[model samples]
Target: MYKYDQYDQALVDARVDEFRDQVARRLAGEITEDQFKPLRLMNGLYLQLHAYMLRVAIPYGTLSSPQLRMLAHISRKYDRDYAHFTTRQNIQYNWIKLEQAPDLMADLASVEMHAIQTSGNCIRNISSDQFAGAAADEVADPRPYAELLRQWSSFHPEFSFLPRKFKIAVTASDTDRAAIQLHDIGLQLVRKDGQLGFRVLVGGGMGRTPMIGHWVREFIPVSQYLTYCEAILRVYNRYGRRDNIYKARIKILVHELGAEEFTRQVEAEFAAMSDLGLDAPQAEVDRIAAQFADPEYDAGAPDTLDRSDPDFAVWVDQNVHAHKHAGYAIATISLKPPRGIPGDASSAQMDLIADLAERYSFGELRVTHSQNLVLAHVRKADLYALWQALAEADLATPNLDLVTDIIACPGLDYCTLANARSIPVAQKIAARFESDLARQRDIGELKIKVSGCINACGHHHAGHIGILGVDRKGEESYQLSLGGSGAEDASLAKILGPGFNKAGVVDAVEKIIERYRSVRSGPDERFLDTYRRLGDAPFKEAVYG
Candidate 1:
């Protein structure tokens, strides 16, 4: 984990003081709602339907035990006993009060965390692969770069007020767990001739107009990484639509100007700035990289888990992942329990997870984009003990990447922008497949994402089975989409036909899964793979008929 230094601590403390003053002014009737809108948004506070919502940034989803404990304390004291972990690798407090928000921010700053850049039209949190350092198939850990970007983009004057919110993600693994293709800018670390570099993709986003990013640079030298990113951001900041909020995303800019022309413009900008010294200094990069050095491990630890208990075996097979190190594994702690809210972790659960991370994972953990938590460096020999502890805390659910492991937003239940309730749909779907573990295993990997509105906060655009909630007159209806993915083979899901009522939506999903099962060439084939092979016709007919 990256520890905050004197400079980092100073910056956060100053921001907390500034926000505290602003909040006081607002509550004293010194500022109107319209006047305070941007001010609050800049600090990651939103006025939701019922109350103020505060989103806290979890940079690249990494957290220390102390930070996690502090979050638990905040939930217990200021919030409603729980916090919602979002798909952007952030956490949200839905029932925040304006007066208490400043205190919350101050508490967060005490633990080296803040809500800056989690909202607003400025660059949002820079995300990375959850299994960054521990993954077996990664070129290198991407967090150091993400941290560097975080430092650089914080309150950058040039990008302070862009057309809309911008998101950037970095991934080093062949498997794209960060959903890089769905971000404003996506960087993939690569090695060519034993020299490290980046493959840059720009303008990929999901909103009203979903788009897969176009590759601007096939390979950019590591030395020019920051410079290249600046060039892309400059172009978007200058030319991206400012009149229409809907068309303000960089993806629209890339769409209007062809990829080739966009690349040409970016190249021209890079060429001019290459000599102006925009590249991050090697010393700075090395300084940040040193903060993320691998943790010490015992060489004598065993590599295998005891599978004598079938329950342990099931949990192991589903929740554990192979690590780069010999005696370690990446353990995913499921937040999606049976009929439970998708990413809501109680205060007690947070404390327990923090304890587990300290005991087994070097006092560090990572939050997944799918709203799960990861003990990224757990020793394989401790699997049984860890499983027992997690089960006792209701955190051991053997449904990683299964249909029951759903991704859902707060929807109409908490969000003012939402037209329908997404949580209930997600709960119903999970309950529908809750029983029959064997049947779920047979179904294999199926990603079901639900969004409350067209904003795509739940990442419904990238799920194998994407559900979007829409308002029809006064009632809520759901639209189903198929064949979407957010992996290395990124693609937008296509809508199936007319919308369905709440119950009909679940039935339609079941029918789609049954249709997939009947047509799959093998049991190991996933829903996305089957859909890719058979197209959407079969699934569409199965749902509509």
Candidate 2:
């Protein structure tokens, strides 16, 4: 977790003060709704269909136990008792009062958190792999880079107002847990010639037009990260479509200009900025890296891998991920309870996670890109005890990367742009496959993502099974997609024929899963492998024909 320095503290404090006055003016009728719209959005406040929604940034999805406790306190003190975790790795309070927003911002600032760049058409939160430091496959932790970008982009005069909301993601593993390919700018940290660098992907986004990003630069040395990033944004800001909000994302720019031409433009900018000394000093980089140093571990500790508890073993197999440390495991706290709202955590649950992170883990928590919480540095020996504690807290669901662990957005509940309710659909899917042991073994690896609209906030286009909600007249309908994946082998999901009505959509999903179960070579083979082997003919037949 990156601690706030004086510069960071001052920035947040100033934003809070600015927003405080803005709130007062709005309340006193000094500004009209139209006038207040951009101001509130810049502060991450949205006037939803029912009430004002405040999205607080978790910055690369990292949170301290104290910060988590503050979130719980805020949720309990203001708004509703629960907060929805978004795909951007943020938490949104859906029922915030307009009058209390300034106070809430001040409270968040007290915890070294804020809603800056959480909304509006500017550089939003820079996200990365939630399991960054703890994932065994990672070459390097991506959070420091994410934190660096956050510092560079937050309130940056050059990028304060862009054509559209921009998102950046970084990862350091072969597995694309951060869904980097779907972001505006995605960075995969890699090692080349015994030095760290990044594989940069740009112009990748989801919305009405969903396209997996194209590689803009390969092996960009880490020393020039901010320079190259600025180059990309500068090009986009200069030429990206702004006449229509629909065509404003960098993805659209990539589409119109083509990857080759876009690469040329970005390269030109990079060349011009090279001598400008845009790279942070080595000392600053070390400072950020030091903030992510590994915690002390007891060297001669007994391995906790031989635990006899079946549930604990199941959880370890499903929920626990490989850690960089020998004795540690990254524990994923699944928010997917049986029939519960996906990614929605009550304030009490949030506090419990905060406590567990402090006691069992390393006083650090991460909000995964999959919309789950993570206790990133739990010792393997303590996993069973952690599981017991989490089970009591209803956070011990063993459905990580499984069909039951569905990734969904807030859909119709809070999103005015949503066509249908997504939470209910996600709940129905999870409830349909509620067996723990059965799912742990049977489900294998599957990514099922659903979104309320074509905006693709839930990243439906990247799921093995993607569901998109559409409004046909007054009724809600859904379209199913097949073969989509957000990994090293990234590909956009293809739509499977006509859309289904609300009731029919669940049955459609059930039918697809049933077909997968029957046609799979063995239980160990994932749905994706089977789908790749057998193609969509069998699925289409079982689903539609």
- lDDT per residue for candidate 1 within 1-545, as digits (tens), equals 78898999999999999998888898899999899999999999999999999999999999999999999999999999999999999999999989999899999999999999999999999999999999999999889989988988999999999999999999997799999988999999999999888999998988778999988887997889888999999999999999999999999999999999998999999999999887679898898899999999868889877899999999999999999999999999999988689999999999999999999999999999999999999999988899999999889999999989999999999999999999999999888898878888899999999999999998899999999999999999999998899999999998988999999999999999999999999988888999989899998899887
Best by lDDT: 1
Candidate 1 — which pairs collide? Answer: none
Clashes of each: 0, 0
lDDT of 2 by residue, 79-195 (tens): 789888888889999999988998999999999999998998899988889888888889998888888999899888989889999999999998888888888999999999999
- Report lDDT (CA) for all predictions: 0.93, 0.89
lDDT of 1 at 2: 89
The residue pairs that clash in candidate 2, if any, are none
